[model samples]
Target chain A: MKVRVHVTLKDGVLDPQGKAIHRALETLGFAGVRDARQGKVIDLELACADEAGAREQVDRMCRQLLANTVIEDYTVEFV
Target chain B: MKVRVHVTLKDGVLDPQGKAIHRALETLGFAGVRDARQGKVIDLELACADEAGAREQVDRMCRQLLANTVIEDYTVEFV
Candidate 1:
């Protein structure tokens, strides 16, 4: 099964990286961009065949390593 | 309007960060992980409302600054 995880910073956290991108866009004349937040996308290929099992395993992976739960949140999807 | 841009390394390109993640997962006893790839996801808040225009502008951003087209690929979506 193929799984995708999106890990993003929690609200109210200072995001220097996102701010940098926002400023860079402004300099490049992308005026329509009001704000920007950057996040991580992890694509995993799992040997598990069962959809439920794969989802469960990927969830554990996210909680254990992929995402820093205190400052970031993650969502998983099967594709 | 909200837009999302997914920037990922092209297949066959070297991915040291991904390799590290894979190795770490294995060390943590995650045996089902066959492979892993890491990418960037940018969430943007745009002043524009038109979906088509927003998509076009984001595509330009990807081509010019957001993605390193030489070894990476990007996808744009309006949310």
Candidate 2:
């Protein structure tokens, strides 16, 4: 089974990297972009084939390693 | 309009960051992980309201700024 995790900064947190991208886009003349935020996607290939078990395991993985819980939130899904 | 862009390393590319994650997961006692690959997600808030126009603009942004197309592949979607 394959699991995908999305880790994103919570709202109200400042994202400098996202700001940088927005600036670069504006510099490049791509108008109409009001904001941009950056996040991470982790794609995991698991030997285990059970869907429920994989989601649980991958959720644990996110809590333990993939995310900084104080500022970032994570969601796990099968992909 | 909201747009999301996913940028991922092409297959066969060396991803040291992903390798490190896998090693850490193994050490942390999570089993059945065959591989782990990391990618990026960028969320953009655009002033444009037309779906077709926004998609086209975001696609251009991906090719020009959001993704390093030589080693990365990108997908753009409306969110």
Candidate 3:
């Protein structure tokens, strides 16, 4: 099974990196760009037998190590 | 307007961070875990007046700064 995990900073969190990226975009001559925020995607190859098992494992991966629950949220998509 | 960008490492790229995470998950007793890849996310509160304009701006942001096209991909979700 293949799984994709997206992890993002929760609202109200300060994103210095995002701010830097926004600045860089303006430097690149992309006008009207208001803001930019950044997040992560994790792709996984699993040995699970079924979608249900993959979902459960992916969820556990996210909660346990793929994301910091205090500051980030994650969703898993299986293929 | 609010835009969220998710950037992830392309396949075939070595992700030590993701590997470390996969190890951590195993240590945490998340069985059936095989592999993991990591990426980044950015969220923005923008002043755009329309979704069409926001979409364009967000695309520019992703192309110019939010993601490294050589090794990353990004998508924007408007809220």
Candidate 4:
């Protein structure tokens, strides 16, 4: 099975990298761009027996290490 | 308007960072995880007069700088 995990910083967190990208965009003539936020997509191929098991395993993975729950949240998708 | 751009390395590209993360996941006891690929999501809040203009501007940004078209492709979404 294939799974995707999206990990993003929650609102109000400071993101210097995103800010740098936004500034770079403005210089590239992308006007009216007010703010920018960055996140990660993790694509995985897993040898799961079934979807339910995969979801459970991926969720645990997110909590334990893939995502920093104190300031970030994650969503999982299975394919 | 809000827009999202997803940029990813094309298939068969070596992703050492993703590989390192995959190894870390395994060490954390995430069994059955076969492969992992990493990508980025760029979220922007823009003061666009219309969606079409925003799309065009963002497309140019992606082409010129936001993504490396040589090794990456991007998709844009407006909200």
Q: In model 1, which residue pairs have backbone atoms overlapping below 3 Å?
A: none
lDDT of 3 at A59: 85
Candidate chain B TM-scores, in order: 0.96, 0.95, 0.90, 0.92
Q: How many angstroms is residue A5 displaced in model 4 relative to the true structure, after the best TM-score fit?
A: 1.0
Please provide TM-scores computed only on chain A for all of the candidate models, following their numbering. Answer: 0.96, 0.96, 0.93, 0.93
lDDT per residue for candidate 2 within B1-79, as digits (tens), equals 8888999999999998899999999999998999999999999999998998888899899999999999999988787
TM-score of decoy 2:
0.97
Model 1 achieves a DockQ score of 0.90
How many collisions per candidate? 0, 0, 10, 0
lDDT of 1 by residue, B1-79 (tens): 9888999999999988889889999998899999999999999999998888888899988998899999999998777
Error of 4 at A63 (Å): 1.1
* Candidate achieving the largest DockQ: 2
Model 3: what TM-score? 0.73
**Residue-level lDDT for A76 in candidate 4:** 98
True-vs-predicted CA distance for residue A17, candidate 4, Å: 0.9
**Which ranges in model 3 have alpha carbons more than 4 Å from their true place?**
B1-6, B42-64, B69-79
Stretches of model 1 off by over 4 angstroms after superposition: none
Which model, 3 or 4, shows the larger lDDT? 4
Candidates' lDDT values, in order? 0.92, 0.93, 0.77, 0.89
